[model samples]
Target: MNHDKEPAKTGTKAGARGLPVLESETLFQGRNEIVIRHQGAEYRMKITRQGKLILNK
Candidate 1:
């Protein structure tokens, strides 16, 4: 009988594939809204009063 547990991942590669990691605290910068541009398109990300995130295109 073998009882072995795999060690947890703690490296940058642990995140989702091909997705760049950014800290919300740094991105938000104490503001509720931030603009993001992708593929020549502009989008807005906002934090609601309830502390939830909302994205608008």
Candidate 2:
């Protein structure tokens, strides 16, 4: 569990201030989607049934 800071607007752990903008460093080659870090854990999400992005931690 992540016991660090508040959740970022991106619904992911935007990391500390002054950090790089790119959240996910490792991306699956030939794939556009990349894993993201939320709160403190890692997760990958797909478009929701409502056409919205849903992240499952």
Which predicted model would earn the best TM-score? Answer: 1
In Å, residue 56's CA in model 1 sits off its true spot by 0.6
Misplaced by over 4 Å in model 1 are 1-20
lDDT tens digits, residues 1-57, model 2?
244744332334446764434332223333444467877888876554464556666
Tell me the tens digit of each residue's lDDT in model 1 across 1-57.
Answer: 123644322335435685545667767768999888999999999999999999999
The prediction achieving the highest lDDT against the true structure is 1
Q: Which stretches of candidate 2 lie over 4 Å from their true place?
A: 1-33, 38-40
lDDT of each: 0.74, 0.50
TM-score of 2: 0.29
Q: TM-score for model 1? A: 0.63
* lDDT (Cα, 0-100) at 31 in candidate 1: 93
Tell me, what's the RMSD of every candidate? 14.0, 10.4
